[model samples]
Target: MPLARSLRLARLHPPQVLALGFIVIIAIGAFLLNLPIAFHGARDLPFLDALFMSTSATCVTGLSVISPGEDFTLFGQLVILTLVQLGGLGFMTMATLVALVAKRRITFKERLILQEAMNHGSVEGIVRLIRRVLLYSLVIEAVGALLLSVRFLLEMPADQAIYFGLFHSISIFNNAGFDLFGMFPGRPGSLIGYVDDPFVNVVTMVLIFLGGIGFIVIDDLLHFRERRKLTLHSKVVLSVSLFLIVFGGLVILVFEYTNPLTLQKLSFPEKMLSSLFQSVSMRSAGVTTLDVGGMRQATQFFSILMMFIGAAPGSSGGGIKVTTFAILVGAVIAMLRGKEDIVLFKRRLARDRVNKAITFTLFSFFFIILGAMILSVTESYDFLGILFEATSAYATAGLSTGLTPQLTGFGKALLMAMMFVGRLGPVTLAFALTPKHEKELVRYPEGKITIG
Candidate 1:
């Protein structure tokens, strides 16, 4: 039956299936959520709001107009969580898990779909990689939940503590950023209320870091001793990830250290913790320890850059991806040095990979700019806030400068489109939209063009 299903699905390309799967899931989620049983007493969720939240959650982007904890009943929250899990680990992955559990073979066409969904290089070992992905996700989220639950017991009842711990662990580990803290009246919500809590801060940051690094990197690290070395991909991801976190934290610390609305009230240690947390969160985790709205405009602009770079490939988090940014930087350096190839860690990158990175980044930039421009006209927010919201959606970074909730219906729709594209990736969406072409049979003569 699974093979037959794959055969029927052959009408659509793998990328199309991957893209369409999200839309179908989002539609079902929105319908379920708009039902009366999904919300708190007598509250009606408009279809648009439901659709927006559904898109956000399904994309693993946490730009919510409605507070998940306050507006959503247990049923609704559960629906959102389900969407996050499906979105965080691509639906194809969940399908693969189902096949594995059912003892059904994953047909080659299905493996091809999984390969595209997971951004894997090939169909070989795709099943094994997915198995490892599921294992790592479960183990990591469990440990994070355990730690958080223990900490929550210090402040809340056992039942509530456990639930909050579980929900937050899954959310943060998936980089979805939804939080139940909003249920506490007058609380600033997110991780802001726990700003000085080192345990929560560290655990949340760890989850975000792990989730942001691609599953391939996690698998590589797990077998490092046996392998005796890391792959070039893993090395680039790790080094770039470390540098971004450290550099972004320092920049935030310096910029906001004396701002009265932000870090001024915090002690040195607390400030450092807040800065570090924001740095990690900017890589698509979205939960913040500081008041993102209160930070200096300069800091916010820098944050846009961080969010734009976002997490590594094959990770739950989004953006153009760290590797894409790295490739562009490497390409620039190579051009400056008059080198023929882009080299890193004693390995040369393929020209096609570099070209794809460039094209991907440009598409992302154009998409965000277009979204921001339309938002500026449709909403009353300032340019910076508009840009931040647009970038946040496009990168699925979920960090907002207080502009999300005020967005008009049209603005929400635009952002939903952005989140959808951002999560699937512009390149993937393009492939899904256009029919595949065969390899070029005719060679064209090279035309001389002026260099930049």
Candidate 2:
């Protein structure tokens, strides 16, 4: 009976198993982070705080109760960075890479998990894809670190600059948004001090933009000889991402142009740079060069919408995703025209795909609203602030409105759950919740209900 029960439990579908894998890794991380050495001055981190940090890092969500630079020791920072990298690359992807490095054969089940994790269409060439992902990620992070180190050298000694550069390079590329600026004087206002520095702004934006665009798209662009040869998914992702960034930047620029606390004092070029950075960071990068708390109300609400849309699929970022949003828009357009199919760039989307997109978007909206509502009761923040915090966590965007560190334990737990669901995805969580063996084998006459 015990063996039977164990087998039944082990029979969880790939999504459920993948979710569990992240949970296990987070547990280990929490344990390591709770150690005395993880903190400065020999103070122990509370278990709940440790779990919250572990979940945030593992989910690649940048929301945190404590400043990484001021609160954690070097060992703790390393642990957080390790979680960010693993979470961004995904647990299964890293596992497959390790197996490959060890010269161990990968089983079909493992391939299935990797396929699901990467959202790939097939298992074919998955190993090769994993290899390319690892190689490309390392090279990109290394180049970013080198460039950032040169910039950081202006502020600190060589050794400190190098360490800060590496930490930020990993954090930015993973869209994790953990920052070391807290160690500096004044408030721990994330890259706010670097808003006028072109090198820092440009380099960090580039890293965030590249990382927000899905790795699959990067691989496709790299390998394809012609633009026409790129996959439809890649084309849609690129087009939507570019449009959102430009549009979001323009909106931010217009709204905050004269806001005294944000962009009013900046030069025209610096204003544009800060606007662009804000737009890109909202794509789930979580790093902010401007005072998010001081921005105009319009900008804050617009940012909430952007955070809800998040980034492209198969990327380190989260949200409903660019592709999902694109599909929903296409579907709406098709419906307005009374077309039977949703078409884009001469390609038609399947009915089920459109339905899934709508479902995911609705589910995302529901959770964001639910979280904000719950937090409004548990915390004393305004609705706008609560909604912003909820959306940021749901999108894993991590741009808080100064309400993060002020949350009650219950509020923090709610946001932690939102981050987990956001990272795993509403659809994936739905799959995990459903019974794996359930199937609709019998059908009756089709029934239709008219509404709207």
Candidate 3:
């Protein structure tokens, strides 16, 4: 009977399992954070605030209601950091570690879950991929921490500098964007104090880029010598990412060049640095060296577009995904050019893939609009601010216009829902909520549709 029950439990849908896993993690994190040890002083941390922070961390959305460094002690900070690491690397990937330690073969059901978790196309070599992913993440984070710690050593004590180094490195690489800079005087928030510091800016941008670029691309690049070529997916992700970064940076520079509150006071080099950082960070890093709230409306709107697009699939970041956006663009081009099939890199795109992309993009838009509409009514913020916050939460981009900290309870709850959906993805959630159905046995006749 116990064996049958275990088997039944294992047979649960992968999406449902993944979604529940995240919820469980968030609940535990929230509980831990609500403890007295988690805070610094006598002020009690509200359960709603604890849950908000936990959801943000576990989802890696970084929409904090309280300052981590100023409000929480080392214990709470560690909990948040652990949540970020787990969230950044999907919880299933972390489970692979336990399996490895136990010397147990990964069950087929678990492999399916890992496929869903990692956003991989198949179950083949899923365990191998997890191993490489873990190794790659640790090595990259180690180097990032080393470099950051060395730099920080020049500014603070050895012990604190080392901790800061490790913390920021993991946060940036995971695209979690939770920073400990708030405790310091004159630091303001985020990476704003490092606006003109080239070393800090460059290191951070590099980490953010790697974190968002997707692990498949990294694996392909590392194995290029053996494969002798990049996969079409890698090519598309790289090309689209490069284009977005450059385009975003240039647009930001042009729009904010003379804005007195942001880039105007900086020298040309400093301005360029800030612009590039914003471009990189907008994809989901959330750590900013510029005044995000002070940017022009045009700049903020443009940023909203970028945040909505978010990072590539299977990466730490979230959004509609680069491939989805790329396919949509391809579809439009093919329609305009009168091509029967969408083609990318001389390869014909599958019809199902195109349909899925359209469906996903539309669903994303619907949710973002829905969330924004609710926030607009519940909060006192302007339309743009509400929309930006909504999109940021849904994209898991974590960029904000200084509106997050002031949200009402309903607003915070709404954003948490957005973050959860953003992380698990709309389609996955749909599947989790939907009951299993048999394949359609009846085929409907085709009917002509009205013209656009």
Q: Candidate 1, residues 55-100: lDDT per residue as tens digits?
A: 9999999999989998998999999999999999988899888888
Off by over 4 Å in 2: 1-9, 41-43, 226-228
Write out the backbone clash pairs for model 2.
none
Model 1: how far residue 287 lies from native, Å: 0.3
lDDT of 3 by residue, 191-230 (tens): 8988989999999999999999989889989999999999
lDDT by residue (1-452, candidate 2, tens digit) is 22222423688677887788788889999999899989876567888888898989998988989888888889999999999999999987787776777788876767777788888879998878888889889999999999999998997999999998999999999999998888775765578889899999999999998899978999999979865598899999999999999999999999999999999999999999999999999879999988899998899999999999999988989999999999989988998999989999899988889889989999999989989999999999889999999999989998988998898889888988999999998888888888865579998999999979
Model 3 deviation from the true structure expressed as Cα RMSD, one decimal place: 1.8
TM-score of 2: 0.96
Q: Which regions of candidate 3 fall more than 4 Å away from where they truly are?
A: 1-10
Please report, as a residue range, the 10-residue window in candidate 3 with the lowest summed lDDT: 1-10
| TM-score of each model, paired residue for residue | 0.98, 0.96, 0.98
The residue ranges of model 1 lying beyond 4 angstroms of the native Cα positions read 1-7
